[model samples]
Target: MKKVYTAIDDFKKQGLDMEIPLKLLMFTGLRNHSLSLLKVGDINWIEEIIVYNAGIDNSKHKVQFLPIPPGLMAALKRYIEENNLKFNDNLCYGIKGIPLQNKQLNRITDKICWDIVNQRTFNFI
Candidate 1:
């Protein structure tokens, strides 16, 4: 399980500067599909909340509200400022493209978590 502390440590070590989404997912325990549909507007930084506006195309649920911790919110704000993230229409664009599709995002996230778990297990051996 990618909990807060582990996620934060991994974020720091990755140095890829794409830690906000990872932190959000780890902290909130959101489904990857729900996360994929998130826009910058969905986040209420002042109130420390993330509104899951709706589920992705194939998902069942429509919407949900997730509480954002101060630490996670702060990190997200910093990431936006550092990256100059612009809110385009209803999307948050990153690096090379618009927000990723659920499958792509899930694969990336799963790889990170798997790597962390594997490394920890190896170290304990």
Candidate 2:
């Protein structure tokens, strides 16, 4: 049988760029606002988890540990190391290198573009 992560296969096929969060959304059911709050430091490499610490100013749903599969965790580790990302850096950055916002995440969905033989250009989201 297919698994929860299997739902993200389509998004993975699209590439591992800015669109990756869409796959995470499907897996975690995390609201865009919550995901946006994530920072590089929130990730706990030893625990294999992503920590989301909700500030007092924010509403409920404070503090969470989202597990990362071994393979994906490895990928994240590599990306972080190769990019020389720091703890204060933002975890999610869009194609234009801007912090990913809720509106932008909402727009992250299946998109079809009219290029060569109806190529699916996901740039719309």
Candidate 3:
């Protein structure tokens, strides 16, 4: 957990665009696939909860909602505004504004953990 926090701090320090999604994953306890599936409409500002829909996946899924922490919610608002996201726009994206794939998210996290383990960046992944 400490390492995860450290990785997040490092991502923030480096001004990585992935910081928000990483924080969301940590705070919401959402699976990588679920987090990657998140869209602007999933967030309920009035209720401060994220609506999770498993239908987006290629498998049987459950619908659920998770409360968003106040601080995270604020950050999310700022992120949405900064990105000019629409109701259906994905919350986390990659190059060309494409929604981030689960593999991409996993690779970034794996790279961060690799860096933490080795105390250096692993560019060869």
Candidate 4:
């Protein structure tokens, strides 16, 4: 967990993009495919959970829910408000505000994976 947090801080220090999605993936254990399927509509604010509402076709999970930590939920709220994201908008977007691609997720994860596997200080992208 410390490593994950450290990795996030490292990303931030580097001025890298996609920091939120990378941190979310680290905390949620959501793979690239699942991350790609997420949208603003999937966040069930009333229940305080991130609903896997991508449906069977778009999601690997069987319509489950992941509890949203207060910090993460707050971040999501701020991000949404700042970007004026609609319910249908992608939860994670690129520089152009488009949905992130699998390659992007892979690139982010590869950095973390290398650190975890090699027990090193950095695996920067």
The best candidate in terms of lDDT: 3
Q: How accurate is candidate 3 locally (lDDT)?
A: 0.80
Model 2 RMSD in angstroms: 5.4
Worst-scoring 10-residue span by lDDT in model 1: 88-97
Model 2 Cα lDDT, one tens digit per residue, 58-124: 5565677888777767767776776677898877765455777887775554232122235433333
- Regions of model 3 farther than 4 Å from truth: 1-6, 12-15, 56-60, 95-97, 121-125
Against the true structure, candidate 2 has what lDDT?
0.62
- Tens-digit lDDT track for model 3 on 15-122? 556667778888888988888889999999999999998775555667888998999899899989998999999888752357888888888877878787888743
Could you give the candidate ranking by TM-score, starting with the highest? 3, 4, 2, 1
Which one wins by lDDT: 2 or 4? 4
Ranking by lDDT: 3, 4, 2, 1
Candidate that beats the other on lDDT, 2 or 3, i.e. the better one: 3
Pick by TM-score: 2 or 3, better one: 3
Best by TM-score: 3
lDDT of each residue in 1-125, candidate 1, tens digit only: 44535654654564433466566667777866666667777887777898876635656665677898888788777767776766643233332456756776665556656767666421110
Relative to the true structure, how large is the alpha-carbon lDDT of every model? 0.61, 0.62, 0.80, 0.76
lDDT of 1 at 22: 64
TM-score of 2: 0.68
